[model samples]
Target: MCGIVGILNRYEAQSSSLHTSLRCLHHRGPDDRGAWQDEYLQLGHTRLSILDLSPLGHQPMASEDGRYCISFNGEIYNYLELKQELTTLGHSFNGHSDTEVLLASFAQWSTACLDHLRGMFAFAIWDKETQNLFLGRDRFGEKPLYYWYDKEAFYFASELKALLPLLPTVPELDPVSIDLYFHYQYVPEPRTPLKGIHKLPAAHYLQISREDWKFTPQCYWSLENIPPVTGDPATLIRQELEKSIELVLRSDVPIGVALSGGIDSSAIAALAAPKYRDTLQTFSVGYPGRPAYDERNQAEALAKSLKLPFHDIELTTEALVDFFPSLVAAVDEPIADIAAYGHYSGMQLAASQGVKVMLSGVGGDELFWGYSWVARAARISELKDHYLQAPTWKAQGIRTLRKLAQHPLYQKLGQSKKVPIPIQSWFRPGIDLSQMTLSPPDRAVFYELSPDFVEALTYRPHLFTQSLWEHIPLDNPYCLFPLSPPTTLDIPNQISQTLFQTWLVSNCLSLGDRVSMACSIETRLPLLDKELAELVIGLRKNQPDHCLPAKAWLKSALKGILPNEVLDRPKRGFQPPVQEWMHAVVRENLETLTTGHLVELNILSKSFVQALRDEFSNKGRHTFMLYKAVVLEIWYRQIVLSSQSAVRI
Candidate 1:
């Protein structure tokens, strides 16, 4: 809901540089701006005025006893409850702002206060007495915090842009991070595209003492650590979801729902309608000519059924092309997902309607078994031990047959690919005997990076680079807290944890925050509430796989509350007309790619780039990859090369 930046220097705190960095974050918080500084530390805050809309709510707020000063971003939904508890402990506050409450709670509980928080947050508390700085990110990384540290100084900010200016020199590109980005479509947390800067992983905090200048990061929470809850999953899910929605609805500004026709959004709208009633509004977007990509009609129908105000935006091919550069800029990272455009445009429409905050159904798919890959993981888990124990020759023979079946000559001979006997199928699992089909992670390995590209760049790949294509053990789910998969969880739950922790946080939530904030709007995800996610994880433990269908538990929980039509509809993701858009964008920007910044950086080969365009034009099967390449090219020109050269595109 706001932007925060700070600098801890061994020499002196520079207020001028702090002001310049804050200017870059102005879009994140346009309501108010304030800065506080001492000899060694400088803290700056840009406020959006979500809760307490008064002068007393201003931050770099100091505690009552003046022992702690804090600059916080994001809402602490349970702040009222914390305040009440603190009051009994002899704490007093002048304002109703969550910032004041947060500072006081830290004063009372110190680092342990993080355990009591239940909402999304990324904040820094400065201790005057101890001269120690503590920085914390929310349990699920709903908010972002990045920091850069060296012997002489430490710099932290809510966004990467703010920290970029404070660095003494231009940051070098991290090759391993670039490789990870290409594989995952986003750089996972604890690592950013820049070499020295790092994101504070979710559910973790960092503390630095001025005395020794030692920095220590510790994990305060983990989904895997919670014990299973005893209850009917359907009932518990309903109760927790409603409670989370109520807390997420806490805001002083107008709020809306980004309702897609999918069950996730539909269910959210259903639950929220009775609470906000006439004041609630709904927004959806669709491709005008692409009916397959259109969901506005379905969204409109659902909104009409609920009698809520509905707004829809039409995205054209031309519009997507024009907005491509700006969209990449808004993301601040190269993300290949085309659906991000839909989110960006939808948020723009909502902002135009004067909505300052919007709730989205983002984590539903990750929490529940909504993806085909997740179900596939369950299938894989069942057969993993058997597959590994099988004879090596038998596995090789099966793999050979699969490749042979796909040969052009074999297909031309009018021979059908042999379906493996049912007895042999268990060894192959989801694999079709006729064609070589790799699992998602295996496919990632296959596409890791072409040796040709690596040689062309002349960059040595490290273990972090190699790990992108390798399988990681999921034993310690927290190993990849804001990044990878789990080890102890069941296969299906492991898949859920992997996707929710890594994909949801790095790709989905990052895009949501950037695009929404680009329009100066705040976006909330009720499904990602810490309590709701924990409850669902516990519920999944006792419930049979069949009992929990893809979001069926939610549908049953809201049985009569939501329309049957909305609840029964199949899952349709927010996909745009990417194939058409990518082809068109590539053709239009072909010239730029040949001479763009990526080529100058020696990261991309001209021949390879041309081949991608050629492949897109002739085969068009690698639309996603081609789009990712284009985005990276543009991003390099804007972010990397723009600083070193005078080029403008």
Candidate 2:
């Protein structure tokens, strides 16, 4: 909902640098801006004005005794309840803004206050008395916080752009992060593309004290540690979702829903319609002439049944071409997914209508078993484990069949390769594992880059050398986190947790925040509410297989609330015409890389880049991979090379 930046300098801090950084984040909060400074620290805030629309709501707000001052981003949905409790404990406030309540809560309970919060947030609270700074992110990372630390100073910001200017020079490119970006389309958390910059991971907080000038990030919450709860899961899920939606509706500005034809959005719209009634608005997007990829009609019918207003936007090829660069800039990183364009357009439409907040249903699929591949993989993993526990001869026979099944010729014959039970396909995008060991059920989950590509990339005319690749261990990328392994839970639950922690948190949620804030509108995800997530996780543990029926429990819970047509329809994700759009975009920009910064830096081979563009134009087999390469090149030029004060790559 806003942008926040701060600097803790080892020497004198400048107000000019703080204001300049805030200018870069103006789009995130155009309503108001404020800065608080002292000898050793400075905090700046850009306000979006969703909660309290008065001068009293201004941030860099301080406690009554002037011992604590804070700058915060995101909504704390349960702020009213926290305020009521704090009132009983003798805390008073002049304004009803969540920011005031958050500062008071911290003053009362310190870092333990995080346990009571139930909404998305990333905030920093500075204690003048103790000379300590506390930084925290939401439980699921719905908001982002990036930081750079050194002996000279420590800098933090809501977005990476704000921190770049404070650096003495452009940070060096992190090759490991670059390789991770190529593998996952987006770099994983706790690491950014810049060598010294790091993202504070979800469910964690950092405490920096002036006593020693040392910072240590500690985890405050984790899905792996959630205690089991027993109940009528269907009813509990419905109640929790409604409760979350009601809290998310706490805003001074008009709110709307980003509805799709799918059950997730449809259910949210249905639940929210009665709360706002005729004032509620809904928005959807589709390709201009691609009916197969369009869901406007379906969304319109659902909106009509609820008697709510509906708006649809058509995305043409020309518009996509024009907005491509802006989209890359908004994303801040190269996210190869085309769905980001759809989200960007939808948010732009909503913002144009003067709406400030929009509710989405992003986490439903990850919470429930929405993706068939994940469910199938879980089942396959379970079956393989069961068979492997049999007698030695039986296990050996099964292993022989697994070897044959993994053969390149056999795998090619099948329409879809039966991914090794323990190896998640999502983590190994565009990777070939023929040379790796393939044992049943117990096959190592780690994977290496393809030998051919490695050989080619390590040859002359490349930015990366062979030694860098050799240094990266072939461990599963998921191992990057210290959380418990997915195998600790049931197969279905394991897959759900993996997707939620990695894909949903890193890719989907990051995209939602960036693109929506690009237009200065705030997005709320009801399905990812802390209470709702806890209920869903408890339900999965109680009935793992029962909960794996592609949102079957959710449909049953909302049987009367939503239209049967919407619930029964198969899941068709928001699919854009990426093949056609990418081909056109790539052909148009292909020549840029021939002499552009990426080739000039020797990170990429011009001939290889030419081959990729030509192949995509001729036959669109590697559309996303090629698109990712193009996006990386553009991002590198704009972010790293174009900065007047940046260091040369």
Candidate 3:
């Protein structure tokens, strides 16, 4: 896990800014830094030295012939295996580093090497032989790649700070994306808050060269393409998870687990503690005064039971408010998760303790049926499908005849009359009389914006300023998500797929990467392992026996591994005291209305700001909505307004 930046063309003009930008990512990789320049391209790398601590692990690493140079940012879990395969094919390496193995695999197979990789990665490989540049992201988007393009010049970076300096001019804020920020708490892929800048969607890749300056992104993998798994789900899930954990634990530096009170983190800690050679340290974050919000007590208990060293940090409301500004800077993306500061503070604590790599249990919830609302959504979406279907002609006609026969007037006066055709059905609207008009199901059934999207609808229109509305008259946020599922998937499986695409990829996974990297800590999520996700999802999709309630599969699988109490306890996720935290934070930062860029730029109106501020001061209504606006305002000031030099932070 490191930071990588590369320019396809115009190397001299961006050289100074490039170095400054790379320096800004010193936190991401402070061990060593390298810069490689060619007439056509310039590549920079900041090394964290996870796999090999020797100089041989240095990057912007080139092939033996110097034909292919790579600036890679993530670990390929199967690099050892790939290295052996490449060596058998007559390729040899000087050092025991994954970087060497990756460059060799690319040299031997080109983009086909992606098929052999099984890990989180966002890398840039420049081929001097063809003057081509290729960029790819991991399947679950555990790693992020942001890029900006033109006909001749192309730039890519792991984070926005480094990529911002390479742009010719600053891009304007995208209103549509900002609206989505309010709706989903983060901008969904492939649009960032800025237009023309994009996040390469998960499971996709892009490549360009001097001949074809413009290249379209291509999707290389998807869960829908894989066949379902058979047999006992618990056994299959456990086997796949163990394989991933074993491979993920192969790291040179010390590793720890982000232990939480919840089942997901406990399960990871339970599995990893036994496999590691030394005792693993566990970290957790909590709210000092808020009992409902803090779960460190339980987390500490789990650590004691596992016999691992434990550490924790308490984020007071004051600390949350004080770090709000830097949190936006660290996040880079204007996500509105209240617990983001917790991820940031926890990493700082871990880094101070000399923990380099951390394992987290992020994807466990999405793979299993963990979210209550998602389960409800699957059932509601099915009900909506039935509601939207139009009545057939035969069914409507039979109903009309029955109504007439039951009427008092028909029974008294026309009971003896033959009444060949029912009056209501005398005339057919369609010439063929069997014409059926179908109404497509509303996408809103499957789409939502958190806590309660339906409740949000009651006052959402009032929150957007009139001037902002005029600029984006056709901004329908629902269009950002998939409306229909393939015929092959069931409702629950399809809902899980959409969450993976939207909530997990764009919000949860993206936020996780930003916070961890901010403190120079690498977080590895084993549950997103290709084989593990495939097997669990495939089992849930096809097997009837696996159709249990939220997290039943995971609970059953870890019954013996984890304490029965740990597996059976209700899931209490990491949540902060939102009403108190946001109300206090927004009240103190209320001047965002007067001194903020959103107001100065006419993106937000004075009236709307005053109304939101009033609510925050009095009843604290729309706390989430108000907090979302405040985060955006701070982001604009801290990031965009200060973007004259991207490395200012």
Candidate 4:
């Protein structure tokens, strides 16, 4: 895991700045740094040295003939296997690391080599012979890659912060993306909040030449559109999941697991515990006195069950407060998720203990429908459909039942609005619904009736109606059985994939990559393997809930390997009690930061900032949104606005 940057200029000029920009990413690769430049291409890289701890592994790695030089970031888990194939085909390796194997694999298979890779990666390979530069991102975007281009030149980097310095002018935010961020807390691809710069979507590649640059992002994977199949899903799931876990264990370095005590992480620990035994190390974190925020007990139980060495960090609000500014700076893009601090603090503790690589069960929920929002979304959509599709008498009966048992009916209906009027007002706009309750999307339909609109339609309730049908589709299973879920794509599947591809890339992965790299730690997510992701998407949709249970698949596969009790336990996400912590520790700093710089910039409203601060100080329920807004505001002042008036970092 490292950072890579490069510049391809239309007109020749000094690129010493590329060195400085790459240096900013020194936290990403404290072990080594390397740079190379020829006629048109200048590439820089920082190395964390996970695979080969030798100079040979140092990148800006060139082919033997010097025709191609590649500056790479990320691990290629299948490099050894690919190396064997290349060796038989007459290629000699100079090192044992995956880096050498990656260049050799490219030499042997070119872009087709990407098809055989089974890990997260982002790299820029320059071909002196073809005068072409190839930039690629991992299949699932576990690693981040961004680029900025104009007619004059093109610049690419491992993080947006590196590229920001090279720009000669201020980049404007895309209004559409700003709105998207407000709705989703992260902007979706291929859109960033900033105009001109874009996150290369997952499973995509781009090739640039002196003449013209072409981007071809092929979908190597997808989870939404799986073909129909028949089988005993439970057994199939068990076998396939085990195979996937077994494959990820092939690292050259000592492998460690991030045991959050959540079902997902616990399952990974359980599966690998038997083989690893004495060598296995498990880690978790909790606030010292805040048991509600701690998973140490659960983690200890799992460790005892597996007989693996367990390590836990008891964090204080004081420690978190000190870490906040540094953590914020590490995240080049502002994000609302405070859980990043927990992950950062956890990684710091783990790395300090001398663990090199750690595995996390990140994709477990996306694959297994673990989150409540996903299930709830399906239920509500189905209820709206049921309410709309019912006979007049049946609909009247439901309405009557609704009055007698509103709570149960609403729970069964799978939709909730504190006040139904807002639902009608937000969607129906100018229409009257005094005698009618329309499904959500129908409200949008009434206002904008385009002749061609099928492709744009989705089953989201917020866009259509506030009532049962506010966002539900008639064909949507969620609409039919609001309480009961559809076997088809429910909230769990769709939300997970959407968040994985978009929000995770734009926010979580981006933030994780930046913060972890900023501290010189190469964070790896074993559960996020692309083949595993595609496999989950390809599974039978009608599989019994046992096979596709909300995070239950992991436990079933681990079976006797992990303790049954730990496997059955609930998910404890990497959530630090930021609200409580901030009120206790950083309330003063929050005020100073927000009022002093953030408000002065006018990027965020002063009134909004103050309200958020007060609400957070008073222990209000909506403090999370306030935290998000203030953090973003501070980010705008520090990274965005500060760059405008001063010399670039």
RMSD of each: 5.9, 5.1, 9.0, 8.3
| Per-residue alpha-carbon lDDT of candidate 1 for residues 551-607, written as tens digits (9 for 90 to 100) | 767777778877788778777788788678877777667668657766656555666
TM-score per model over all chains: 0.86, 0.89, 0.90, 0.82
- Number of clashes in model 1? 3
Worst 10 residues of 4 by lDDT: 444-453
TM-score of candidate 3 versus the correct structure, residues matched by position: 0.90
- Checking candidate 2 for backbone clashes, the offending pairs are 462-602, 463-602, 463-603
Summarize candidate 2's per-residue lDDT along 1-649 as a digit string, tens digits.
8999998876555444576678878989999999998877889999999998999999889888999999999999999999999999999999989999999989899999999998999999989888888999998999999999888678899987777876667787676776767667787787888899998989899999866888778999877677677888778988988999899989999898998899999999999999787567999998877999999999999999999989989998888888888788888766777788899999999998998999998988877778765555455544444554669887676666666666655555443446553354432311222222334235322222233233323332343445444545554333532222234565556656666666787789898999999999999999999998888887677777532458888888898899788888989977888778887667667778667765666555667677766776677645555666778887876656555453211
- lDDT for model 1, on a 0 to 1 scale? 0.75
Candidate 1: deviation at residue 528, Å? 0.7
- Clashing pairs for model 3 are none
Prediction 4 global C-alpha lDDT: 0.66
Give candidate 4's root-mean-square deviation (CA, Å). 8.3
- Tell me how far the alpha carbon of residue 610 in candidate 1 is from the true structure, in angstroms, after superposition: 2.9
Off by over 4 Å in 4: 13-15, 214-218, 224-230, 382-496, 542-549, 582-586, 589-601, 608-621, 641-649
lDDT for each candidate structure: 0.75, 0.78, 0.78, 0.66
Ranking 3 against 4 by TM-score, winner: 3
Quality of model 2 by C-alpha lDDT: 0.78
Q: Which stretches of candidate 2 lie over 4 Å from their true place?
A: 11-16, 383-391, 400-471, 474-491, 617-621, 645-649
Best candidate (score: lDDT): 3
